[model samples]
Target chain A: MKIELDNLTVSYQRHPAVHHVSGRFMAGEATAIFGPNGAGKSTLLKTIMGLCAPDSGRVRLEGVERQAIAYLPQQSEIDRSLPVAVLDLVSTGCWQRSSWFRRVDRAGMDAAWQALETVGLADFAHRPVSALSVGQFQRVLFARILTQNAQLILLDEPFNAVDARTTEDLLELVPRWRSEGRTVIAVLHNEEHVKQYFPQTLLLAREVIAWGNSAEVLTDDNLHRAVDTAAHWLERAPVCHVDGSAA
Target chain B: MTLALYDLVVSPFVEFGFMRRALIACLALALSSGPIGLFLVMRRMSLMGDAMSHAVLPGAAAGFMVAGLSLPAMSLGGFVAGVTVAVLAGLATRFTSLKEDASFAAFYLLSLSMGVLMVSRSGNNVDLMHLLFGSVLAVDDAALMLVAGVCSVTLVTLALIYRPLLLESLDPVFLRSVGSRGGLWHTVFLLLVVLNLVAGFQALGTLMAVGLMMLPAITARLWAANVGAMLAVACGVAFASGAGGLLLSYHLELPSGPSIILLAGLVYLVSLVVAPVGGALPRYIRARHRQL
Candidate 1:
């Protein structure tokens, strides 16, 4: 499915976290959103997932239902203290099909186990989520998202705090998903990482600096401009425009 | 000793109908409160239970003043009051700069004072005492019926929402992403809490009602690692304390409500020292083994 953001703006506590921006994510491609800290990379991704409302404009997903889009928030957002087992947590990915009224049957359980096997976490299936290492927990999250069988995946900093081996293991899944004709959009920090894996990049600093081919958009000048724009965003007054587009 | 045992433990319940009624009422509370309290503990809202208990007082007082110790009246009033405080505090945290804990504390304090004043103005010391520390042994048929009905509804509602509630409590963001309404589940869970509290206050009183809810969960945490195991252990502990407290009240001429809570407290204290998983002794032994 293709996603188009048309002049999207999201504000938190009356200050625009994601300013008026326009971009497009092509179908069946892996795209990375890279920016400096507080550049609203995650906010834009959230807006696409409909987790956050836009103060203006809208996100348009074509050729797919909203339910076909899956989201994987940062690992820190999970409450690990819950007594849920890894297997149970993963099985919840089938929630859209079974819903709360129907119990997860043998087939669903088998799929959950399969997802765990794919993530190399089959042995940890029955273990409490709290007992897993940070990397292992992230893998469990990936396993859950895999079971979602979604056409589009939105991830927020999936590699943060993850070890190199684990990161490599998880990175392999992105291409495998793209090969299967699924779109993956992720909020990533490492410029080198983005340059290596993602063909498309959206460079943002509370607004779009550049959006297109990774190599062209990730130039040093664009990165420097992104950082400068993000740093002084609060001091700049709103550029009021009758056309509903920021100058 | 056998005769003494019969006199101490068996005779009170076997011979007296009110004692049996009290035991039955407690058993119902235990069955429902154990699971409810487990969720509260897991959510780290232990103190919220305490605040909700205190907030129910003025409502119960108002009910008594208007209807004169009627079960339905007091329970309805208490449910409304508890839910109002919870909603108001929740709104305060969401809309204002105040934190949830601070808002709950502020609302409950105000509720406590209002309850005391309202009760003092309209009712006698006996009535106030009954609201503070319940008359479990004097549980009438109407009160018994109310408790049973609430327990049934609580158990059924909890079972129906168990999956969404678990997902919401553990991974709310994930729950939302999956198209589940976390807000609806949250409201349903809070309503369950209010229901259980309204039922419990009729028997355990406002001050000690949360004791039945919290003590069993605390004791269970020491011994049980999984959620299923924790709920089972908590229910077992709750029933044992209820039965033992009633027997003690019958033999030693003690207050039934205090007796039950104290027994539950004792079970919690003992579990802290001797429980198999997280107990002090087991932890000490594990540390020693690691050193070796």
Candidate 2:
């Protein structure tokens, strides 16, 4: 599915986190949102997922409903210490089909098991999430996303604390999802990983620094500009009144 | 020995109608409040139950002011007051700089002071004592009905919202991403908490109502491995405490509310040392085994 951000400006307490920026992610594309810390990368994804209301502008999905998108927020956002089994956590993805009240049927359970198998956590299905390591928990989360079967997937810093092997294992899923005609948007920190995997990249520092081919967007000049822009970000900056111009 | 056991345990409940009513009231409160308390512990809002119990005081006092010692009036007033505190605390957390626990603490303290002031200003210490420390032996038919009704509603509502509530507790962001309204379920959960606290206040009183809710749940958390097991254990603990406390009160002439809460506290303390899951003995054993 294709997604479009039209002049999106999201703010926290009237301070714009994502400034006026507009772009469209084409169908079945693998895109990485790369920027310095606090550059509104996660906020932009959240706005698209309808978790955050933008201060201005809007995010429009061209060919999918909101439920057709699955989001994996950063690991910090999830309470992994909760007393839930891996299989139970993954089975929640069937909520779209089961909604609120209906029990997850045999087929849904099978799907959850299949997702766990794919994520290599089949033996740990009954294990409580608190028993899993950071990487193992991330795999469990990805397994949940697999069960979601969404046309669009948004991942925020999916590999922050993951080890090398687990990172590579999860990295393999991005191309597979793209091949299966799904759009993947990830907020990434590693430039090498982005250049190697993602074909398109949006370099943002609260506003668009670059958008297009990954190699082009990750240029030395653009990278420097993103860091500089983020470093000099004023905490008490005045609200933007400009019409369709970068703040 | 058997005859003494029967006289100590079953005779009081069989002999006195008020004792029977009190036992049933305890059973009803345990049935509903146990599961709610489990959720509170799981949500790390154990103290929230205490705050809500205090918040119910002003409303119950108001009800008592309107109609002295009436079940319906007091319960309605308590429910309204508890919900208002919950909502006001929620709004303060959402809109203001105050965090949820801090806001809850502030609101509940204010409610407690207001309730105390109102009760002491108009009525004598006897009325205030009755409002604060409920008389389980005085649980009349109307009080019994109210407690039972609240229990029924709490159980049914909890069953209906069980899935969403679980998801909301464990992974709210995921629940929200899937397009479900986690906030709505959270509000509903809070409402159930207030309702259960209001029901509990009828027998345990405002001071000790949360004791029945939290102690059993905390004890259960130490013993149970999962949510289902925790809920079952909590209910069992609550009922056992209620029954044991009632029997103890019947024989010793102690206050029923304090007796019940003290029994639950004893259970919690015992569980803290002996429960297999995260108890002190288990951890110590594990450490010794590791050294070996």
Candidate 3:
């Protein structure tokens, strides 16, 4: 699916975290969003996922319903200490197919088992999430996203705090997803990983700094400019208007 | 032997009408509040449970003042007051700079003072004590019926919202991403807490109602490994403690409500020290082995 952001602005408590930004992520393409700290990459992803509304403007997904979109927030957002079985957590991905009150059918359970096997967590299916290591927990999360079977996947810092082996295993799925004509947008920090895996790149510092091929967008000049923009943006004061309209 | 067993264990319940009434009421509270307590502990909202119980005080006091110890009046008043504080506290957390726990504390304190003032202004000291402590032994048919009705409603509603509620409590961000409204489920869960606390207040009194919900659930957590098992263990502990507390009250001539709560406290302390997995005994043994 092709995703479009049109002059989207996200503000918290009247301070704009994401400035007026516009871009389009082509279908079947793997795109990476890079930014300095507090550059609003996560905020932009949240707005696109419909979890947070933009202060002004719109995010449009061409020809795909909102439910077809899957989101994997940062690992820190999940409460791993909860006493939830791995299989039970994975089965929740079928929330769209099953009603809230109904039991998971045999077919759904099989699908959850298959997802677990794919993530190399079949043995841990009955184990509580708290018993798993950080890497295993990340894989379990990926397994849940796989069960979502969404055409559009948005991941925020998917590799953060994960081990190299698990990262490689998860990275292998991204290109395969692209091969299947699925759209993947990820917020990433590692420049080398982005250049190796993602074909398209959007460098943002509260606004789009550069958008194009990974090799071109990752230029030393653009990286410096992104840092400069973030530094200056925080220092700049808000302009007061007589009519009191500022977003 | 059978006669001896019956006399030791079943005689109090079989022989005394008040004991029978207390047991039935205790069972109703256990079956309903136990699961709610499990949820509360799992969600790390045990303090919130205490705050809400205090918030329920004014409503029950007002009900007593107006209707003279009528069960429905007191329960309805408590429900309204608890729900109002829960909603306001939630909103304060969302809109203001205060955290949820802080907001709950502030609101409950205000609610508590207001309730105390209203009670003192209208009723006698004994009336205040009854509202504060409770009168579990003197449970009438009307009070028992109210507890039963609340339990039925709580079970049915929890069943309908079980999956979403579990998901919301464990991983709310994921639930929200999947198009399930986590906030609505949260509100519903809060509503259940309020309803259960209101039901508990009639027998345990507002002062000690949360003990029935929190202590047994925490005790169960020391033994059980999963959510379902924890809930079942909590109900068992609650019921067992209720019976034990009632027996202690009968034999020793102590007040019933405080006796029941104190028994639950003793059970929690025992579980903390001796439970096989997470308790102190195993940890101490492991330490000794390591030293050896």
Q: What's chain A's TM-score in each predicted model?
A: 0.94, 0.95, 0.92
- Misplaced by over 4 Å in model 1 are A236-239, A242-247, B287-292
| lDDT digits (tens) for residues A170-193 of candidate 2 | 999999999998999999999889
Residue range with the least summed lDDT across 10 consecutive positions in model 3 chain A? A238-247
Rank by DockQ (best first): 2, 1, 3
Model 2 TM-score relative to the real fold: 0.97
Give the candidate number with the greatest TM-score: 2
Q: What is candidate 2's lDDT per residue for B1-292, written digit by digit as tens?
A: 9999999899999999999999999999999999999889888898899899999999999999999988889899999999999999999998898889999999999998999888988799999998889888899998899899989999999999999998888988888888899889989999999998888887988878889999999898899789899999999999999999999998999999999999999989888999999799988876534542
Error of 3 at B26 (Å): 0.7
> Candidate 3: lDDT over CA atoms?
0.87
> Model 3: which residue pairs collide?
none
Deviation from native of the Cα of residue A214 in model 3, angstroms: 1.5
Ranking by TM-score: 2, 1, 3
Worst window of 10 by summed lDDT in candidate 1 chain A: A238-247
Better of 1 and 2 by lDDT: 2
Best by DockQ: 2
Predicted candidate 3 versus true structure: per-residue lDDT over A99-215, tens digit per residue: 678888788888888889988999999998999998898899888888888888999999988888899899888998999888999999999889999999999998789998999
> Where does candidate 3 stray beyond 4 Å?
A234-236, A240-247, B1-5, B287-292
